[model samples]
Target: MAAEAQGRAPDRGEGRPLRWRRRRSLGLTLLALGLMLLAGWGAFTVSVQRRTEQLRAESNHQLDLFAAAVQGMVRRLEPMPATVQLSTEVQALLRQPGDAARVQAASSYLRRLNAHLGGMQLFVQDQRGIVLAASDPALVGDDLSFRPYFLEALSGRVGRHFAIGVRDGVPGYYVSHPIHDGAKVVGVAVLKIGLEPVDEAWGMLGAPALLADSNQVVILSSRPEWTYTALAELPLERKVDLQVTRLYGDHRITRFPLQVDLRVDEDSQIVEGVLPAGLGASGAQGRSAASRGMLVLGRTLDGTDWRLLMFADLRPVRQQAAQDSLLAGVSAGFVLLLMLLVNQRRRIVQQKLQLNAELEEKVTARTQALSETNARLRKEVREREQAEHTLREAQDELVHAGKMAALGQLATGITHELTQPLGAIRTLSGNAVAFMQRGQLDAVSGNLAIMARLAEQMGAIIEPLKGFARKSKAQPQAARLATAVHNALFLYHQRIRNEQVTVHDATADSPLAAWCDPNRLEQVLINLIGNALDAMREQPQRALWIDAAAQDGRVALRVRDQGPGLDPALRDRVFEPFFSTKSAGGGLGLGLAISRDIAREAGGELEADNHPDGGACFTLWLPPVPHDAVP
Candidate 1:
């Protein structure tokens, strides 16, 4: 019995070593599997982060396009409201709202203008906010005194607002401009543009977007149900204000079911939401990807207290990340199993040696490649510098040549101007001498006076030529833009008169100033005006319009000609050096090129485009100088 006990004890001790080894092996396998799981989670997190950023960038780009379209529409309509100031009927109606004849005339005029403007409703309201006349007969006599836009215009300002129409139960964007009787505001002219077109356009873009006002109420949306819904919770005060203003009319404003599950950043978020019935897609079956979840991005509209929000579907991004995570986990498991089955220690050592050797070889090869690339880059940089220097020298020569060409072109007109004055002076002097000989004192004095006036006239014609021919140092400072426009016109007076062109000068109506060299500004204006005149040379009813206005910290002067508009394909190439549409020997085509350079030197830009009405328009934009700074 004692011997059997001793044999069992030795056997048990032997089995202890096997058990210990088994347990150790099991622990290592578990650790590897755990690490693999962690790696999978890490991959998933990283992928989600990357994909979210990509989605954000894409949404931002789309937002920019949408914002641009919105702003363009508003800008197109904004000018329409101000055009009412030019209507005599509108002016007459405002002066005497009680006059039935004037009211009918204004209404008829507005109706015609509205038809021409694609059905935008136009109305004129008196100082008392009583609608005297409107393109839509039903809108007349409507009391709009309580409206914010009316109050804004009455305070002598341009008013812009978006609201639901009280009469028609439709949404519209209103633009109002004051009718000024000298310095006093007499009445308001308003244009109401339907938002359905904008909404429809947005819907066609596929991506979901909404436009929210300052109170966080959606005014315009690609989704109809989203309109009038609050993007966030509206405070009591805001709700009261909306009710009082009746901005959204009788529409019940409620909080949208948007829950922010994650805040990506200040301008981005992951939200779960569904739009209202009117804004949501009708007859939709189950929960769509947008309804399930979406990424939201927001941007403030330019020049307005409104925000544009875009929604991007997030399902694809999440699905892709999940698939990548699963693949990573499976790959890790497969690699782990192979390593365990092979003599893990030996295989790991071999892989480490091989990896280190390959790394060293790759490092050496990359160093050589980078060194060669660096040398090539340095050579290319030198070549580029030389090329730029040569181009600059050539540009300078071209500028000089352009100035000479302009002088040559003006020579004909200058000669005609000078000859007339010279001939008159000669005749007057001869007559003065004849009168002196006859001893008619009073007649001789009159002849001498006339001769002196003729001599001064000749000097006036010669002075501009001398000033224009002589190059002046570039010194950008405060200068009157209106003055530059007038000076350019003075240079083209002879050509303008010869062609019988009707000139409309709006710049003379206001004091506009810009930061630019007076000589360079005049030169640019002269080039623009010359181009306009050339464009109108063959046109029967020639006319030119020059307008200047200060906007967004810049002064813009536009020269428009009544001629065949520029060809679309040629518009972009118009400023290219040596590019021209002129007849042979008519111009060197360096005028616009040199003018553009001068504009840039003075921190401005020159733009060319075909006006919407009819003609080529050249606009020069310069940094504005404050009214007080104008010397």
Candidate 2:
């Protein structure tokens, strides 16, 4: 019958609280999930863009180096053909092409030079383009009349051409200079140098690098398969010329397959890599490795028709960028989530305040109704009286709870404080007992007196707690602030000793005079010191320093602790009542708020901030009294 009378839904008092809790939980969960998704999405896009830019810059730098290498190689090898024509060995061989001894000696000398220098097959050819004494003895009788370099040299000018060797179908650069026999051009001296050495040098760089001719043919390539390939389709005229000269031998002018991913600049670009047709068709998975992304940069060599190119794998850079951006975004999102939590907590507190106000209004109305019904019904008056008693008891419980919080901190220190004096009394009493047994009357009396003093010291320690518990609304007086500091240290002496905490009195030289109740001030200091001890529980070294200084015509009493400083984000809320960083049952966070109120009543202020060196500094600024009014 009672459940039916109450209706289908639970009471407002019971179900409302549960409903609010559920709402809060749902909101927080949704917010956290949203943060993660937003962070991931934002991270991925931003990371890709930044990674691309960085790789582009790196590719450009590599391109500069590549171009410089080709230009430097050209400068080094360009003069060799003309310079070798003037070589004494070459001149002797050219002066007497029919001399067998001179021919052998010249070919041997050319072979040694070609081996030491970074070039392939340094040789000599006659005016008719016939292979004369050569670096390779097998090429001595090879025909070269079909080549353009020899024809150009016979016209009394230095000539250069890239063509296949007339002796073998192997491609090489042909450079020729006409030999002068006393001011008349008699024959042409030619140098045939292969590009294999340049290709080998490019391979050692650990990147895909290549050199291409004016016709866009990949003449020298670090990757063997890429050689003889063209970057783009060749025109008919160039193709026909290459075919006639047989520059690339029997190899087809195939195009290197690449898919452009992005263009970094005119000289540098990015591409996606995959196995080429032949490699893929042959099922050579390991042989032809796939690249995620490759950066390629190209530049033309100065004074030459060749272009230098560099390619690098950019997969690692992109991956790192992704990781870095995700970490940054997640960190930012976490900070934002914390801010949301704090804002929600603020709203919850405001809601609690509103509920309290509404409850108070309802109670007032209920009291008025009970008062009016008392005359009509005496039975209800007793019930109303019981309700008042219950309300008073609830108020008392709240006060008791506040006192318990302070007492919990004092409890540990009290135990440690009494231990030392109690031990001393025991020792002295034991000595007295021993002396009495030996019939030493004077020594027994002396030990008894010492025990009495120890007992009195223990009483002195217990006396303050009684006064602290019975706090009074006492008015401020002109008292020396240093006295309160000393009392705090004295009360916490046992805790300090037990915890191995070092205490410093920076204001011992100059006493701090302030207008405040000494007992109340001492309680505040004890509270701070106890809190410091708890904070430094995890610290290896514990220390506390009390500093006093004059600031803005007021005496500031600062308590500093060598413990982890107050969190910057939570510093503003530290003085709020019932706000605590400690775990459940540790504290109610009422101490600092109460202390601040007491300071205001005593014409003082309390402020907290992080110290310059480390830890937290709680400064109690009081109205300064003259030295004459120190008491």
Candidate 3:
């Protein structure tokens, strides 16, 4: 009986050990599964992030290309309006809107020009915005005064706007330039380019494209249905404006149904929502097609107040991440199974070595792939940066070209100045020779002195140019304001006489001095005087007034011209680089801009305003030199 009880007790003890081993094995298996799931989740997250980043980079590149193409297309016709404004027939038409001969000639000229330009519409508008002549004669006498482009052009600026044609209903971009009869904006020359070419350009894009204006109104889009839609809600005032302008030709503006699901970056976003139907989709299919994850990217078009938007499918990125996660899970589960299958110490070590080898090979392959991708991305970035550097260099070269043109104009003035002196010197020498032959010693001597003085005057004129050409000193020196004004007037004495302009130099004897580079101060004075001369060229009463005063350690020199005072609207922009109110070839508009910069460099300022009596007045303020520092 004792032996039988002992055997049963041993069996029970063995059963307890067996049950504990089974429970321990189950816990280990469960832990392995959990570890596999964690690895898969981590892989999925990493893959999603990596792919999203790649998509963002790719979308941005695409957007850049798209914006550049659109800009190139738009700029192709920008010069046409300005060129047409210079046409004699067009100007004549503006001058005589009621003259049939003038209107017919202008229309014929525009017709030929429009045909030459290929698909661009040309028209002329009077200051009242009445179309006096057009390539399409039917458009003649059309009242387009309500158009935004017309209003902008009437204000003496190069105007740009996009809208549908009121008559033809065709979408087009309008570029308008003011036709100046002297200082007055007599009329406008308008060039309207049809969007058919731009629309045809969409064939190159694989995704949807949208171009929105400053008001967030989508003016151009790949999908026809999306056209004329607002990217956001329109303000009541804006709506009223669009209504009055008839910008879209009676097209009702509505908000596009697009919702941003996430912001990936400043210029990238994730969009998810059911937008309006695409090309041909309808009903349930249309909704399904529109309802999808999309990567939206945007960029501003250079040189215009327009934004471009593009979309890419996010399904591919999500799908790739899912596949990667599944692969990671399979790999981890296979490794766990191998570990469980091998129990012997030697076999366990061998299995671990094999698993590690597989993992290392996979990790090495992934790392190589990522490195290759990074290398490609870096190469692209470097290439883009290099391209940008080249563009900047080109811009600098253009600026230098403009400066050279300005120099040529100055040289022309210099030639005129020298011609007069040369002629006088030749006449004086001939007279001197006659006097010497006649035994008139005093007359000959007097002629010689006069000749010498003329030569010296010529030298004085040439000397300013030489100094202006030479590099300036590092620091400003004391300069006599009166002397600078005198030299500037001496350079333009011929023009002043030719134009019969009366000059009033209140500063000719002033004792004011300024702390500034002498050559630069002279240059500023020359520019101010030249501008004053130009302003009074067509005035009935041609007069210039120059004055100087000292106050609070500063000297203010003012140049006032009798011509139509600086257009009240253009007063603030007179000093902007390349913003010229002059006709083509008059100048690049850099004179005032350069003068302003020179003044600021010398610790001073330049400003423009209308004088109380009525004329354009430019004031140059410079740091005053102490009486003791005067040289």
Please tell me which predicted candidate would have the highest TM-score against the true structure: 1
What is candidate 1's CA lDDT for residue 410? 60
The candidate 3 region of ten consecutive residues with least summed lDDT is: 268-277
What local lDDT score does residue 103 receive in model 3, on the 0 to 100 scale? Answer: 92
Write down the lDDT that model 3 would get: 0.80
Cα error, candidate 2, residue 473 (Å): 76
Clashing pairs in 1: 224-278, 224-279, 225-278, 225-279, 226-279
**How many steric overlaps are in each model, in order?**
5, 0, 0
lDDT of 1 by residue, 1-631 (tens): 9999988998999999999999999998898889789878988998988997898777777777777788776657777878887899988777777899999999999999988886458898989999999999999999988788899999988888887777887778888999987888888988888766667678544677788877878888776766787866788887788888898999899765453332334343222222322233223421353354567677676666677777777777778888889888888888888878787778777887879988788889999999999999999999999999999999999999998887785674356336545655666677678988888889888877766755665565444444434533366788887787876686566668878999999988567788877766776787788888889988988999999887778888889999998999889999886688999877767678767777776778999999999999988889887566665
Which scores better on TM-score, 1 or 2?
1
Cα lDDT computed for each candidate against the true fold: 0.77, 0.71, 0.80
TM-scores of the candidates in the order shown: 0.50, 0.44, 0.50
Every candidate's CA RMSD: 25.2, 21.8, 29.2
lDDT value, residue 462 of candidate 1: 49
Pairs with steric clashes in candidate 3: none
Candidate 3 runs further than 4 Å off: 1-19, 261-290, 341-631
Sort the predicted structures by lDDT, highest score first: 3, 1, 2
